[model samples]
Target: MKRLIAWISDLRLAIGLLILIAIASGLGTLVPQQESAELYHRVYDAQPWLGLLNGNAILRLQLDHVYSSSWFLGLLAWLGLSLILCSWRRQWPALQAALRWIDYSSPRQLSKLNLAETLSCSDASQELQRLEDLLSQRGWQVQPHPDRLAARRGASGRVGPLLVHAGLVVLMVGAAWGALAGQRLERFLAPGNELELVNRRGETQLTVALEGFGIERDPAGRPEQFRSQLRLQPGDPNAAVPLPASTETISVNHPLRFQGMTVYQADWALAAIQVQLGQSPILELPLQSFPQLGDQVWGIVLPTRPDGSNPVLLALSSEQGPVTAYSAEAEILGTLVPGGGPAEIAGIPLRIAGVVPASGLLLKRDPGVPLVYAGFAIALAGGALSLIATRQLWAIAEPKQHKLHVAGLCNRNLAAFSRELPALLTELQQG
Candidate 1:
């Protein structure tokens, strides 16, 4: 049991676990996560890089959602346990030892330190007082005795390793918590459409309203930006008194944050277009993708006569532009711009009233984000603390012999401390 605990708490084991977790995270980034099994088969079945990883293999290995996978969570759990154990077994005790002042009975023990200096001086009492004052000014905590004095500085450095371990554990816990309980939602909402925020259990929590959405296109007709104007209401639909709605606009990199949830403008799509045909009621035609025709082309089939006699295909590549009509034989019949007057196609007049655009918003709620940020802050502070060099100085004033013995030791920056010690001795001798 002792051996096992030691091995688990070993620094090497922690480093190995970190490396494994990093590799797993990299793999998670490379693979599209939480997608359907069919998508995995369609994407990787014929790909040379991951061709051998079929749908079954992906599912069996939990590669579809690596962060939430049992193996990855197990690694996190193991690493957290290791950090806790190491902190408990090593860092805590070391910190306690550093905080406690150990009194040396003789100068011999002090002289044996890795960095040590001995000094001889007259007027032992005055020199000892001056040394104590100098050490105090240098932030050393002094412990005085009748025969000797012990002083140490930068003892907080010992606490740094403990905090570092604690921060790592907190970080791992946050990541695990996020992977286990966080929620994500992707939706395409048209203007004036309202959607309720639902949990994994399908329970509505809040309400989201899409006020408007727009896409900015470049000179070459490529999309440059997608923006969504949204409103967030606090409560579910069943609330007795509905909360005030807050409005926000989100663009590509800018996201709206509210009630611990973030709404990102991920994409945009042409939902449908309202068109009037020959004095009939406005027909809302839902657009379908025609990638073979053009990458951004969307179209719908409509009958020319009121009796649904002659079918014609109407296609458009952009929301702002000319919608082309095609005959059953695939020949171009006519072209009509959006909001343009009715144009005759196959002897029936057609008018495009308006285009409906949908905003694709990705909503995410991660409860562990605060914890992760806090852990990073703590880790940075601990790393800064660890850089402080803990230096110690000891002195004995033997008044009867009319001499003072002094020695210094430092855990870091030994050469600088060595030079400072000699200068301090010279000051004591001259004074």
Candidate 2:
């Protein structure tokens, strides 16, 4: 049992676990996570990732969702175990030892320390008292004994490593908790469309509407950013308190945070086309993706003749118009811009009214996010606290020999502390 504990608390084991977690996290970043199986097949089936991982292999190994994978969670658990063991076995004991004062009784005992000094004094007892009083004034916690005195400063530094381990454990636990119970939903909705949100029990909790969407473009007509305006309202019919409706805008990195959920604007797509044929009512045709033509191309078929013969394929890539019409022979019949004049395709007047676009929003809710944030704050504070130098001072008064012995130790910055030791002795004698 002792050997097993020693191995678990080993520094090298902890470092190895950290490295593994980092590598796994990097792999997760490289792979697109939580995508549809069709996407995985399309992307990884033909050209396997890393020349080894095919879609089948990825799905089987749960690589498609690495952060939430069992193996990844196990790695986090193992790391947390190492941190807990190291803290319990080593850091806690060291902190306890630092907090406890130890007395040194003689000059020979004082000389055993790294930095020590002995000075002749007219009144050794008075000097010892003065030294204790001065150390207390200098923010040292002094403990006086019959023949010796021990004091410590920056004892809080000993707690830093323990806090670091605790913080890391909390971080891993929070991440694991989020992976196990967090919720995520991705939706592509046209403007003025609403998406329903549900809780863990699958009851409706809220409704979010895509009130507006716009794309900022460069002078060269390339989209720079996609922005979506959203309106949120409570949807539960059995709720006691009425939740007020709220409106907000979200973009790629700027997400809307509300009631423990975050809504991100992820992607944009051409949804539909509005067109008028002769004196017919304006027909809004839903667009279908034409991946063979281009990544962003969408198409809809329109009858050009009264007999429903010689149908025209209307395709558009963007909302900033110029839709192309293709005949059955795969020849371009005409190009009509939105709000432009009617185009004669097979002798039928067709005019493009407008384009409808959809915004892809990804919503997520994680209860562990607050815990993760707290762990981050704790780790940061621990890192800063670890830099403080823990210094210990010991003194002994020998009235018979008319001598005062002083010894000091600092956990870090020994060279500077060594230089300061002699000055500290001088102050002790002068006092």
Best by TM-score: 2
TM-scores of the candidates are 0.86, 0.92
Q: Compose the digit string of candidate 2's lDDT tens values, residues 1-431.
A: 99998898899999998999899999899989999999888889999999998999999989899999999999888888889998999999999998888777768888989998888988888888888898889898998997679998998988899888888888888898888989999988999899888766898889999999998889988889999989999766687877789889999899988888888889888888999988889988899899888888999987766788889899888888789999998999999999888988778888998999999899988888988988888887888889899999998989999988899999999998898778877776665
Q: RMSD (Cα, Å) of candidate 1?
A: 3.3
Would you list the clashing residue pairs of candidate 2? none
Q: Tell me the spans in candidate 2 whose CA falls farther than 4 Å from its real position.
A: 199-202, 240-243, 301-313, 326-333, 345-348, 429-431
Collision pairs in model 1: none
After the best TM-score superposition of candidate 2, give how far the Cα of residue 362 lies from its true spot, in angstroms.
1.1
lDDT of each residue in 205-324, candidate 1, tens digit only = 788899989899999888899988888877655677877888889999999888898889988878898999889899888888786798678899888777987899999878886899
Give the distance in Å from residue 416's predicted Cα in candidate 2 to where it truly belongs. 2.2
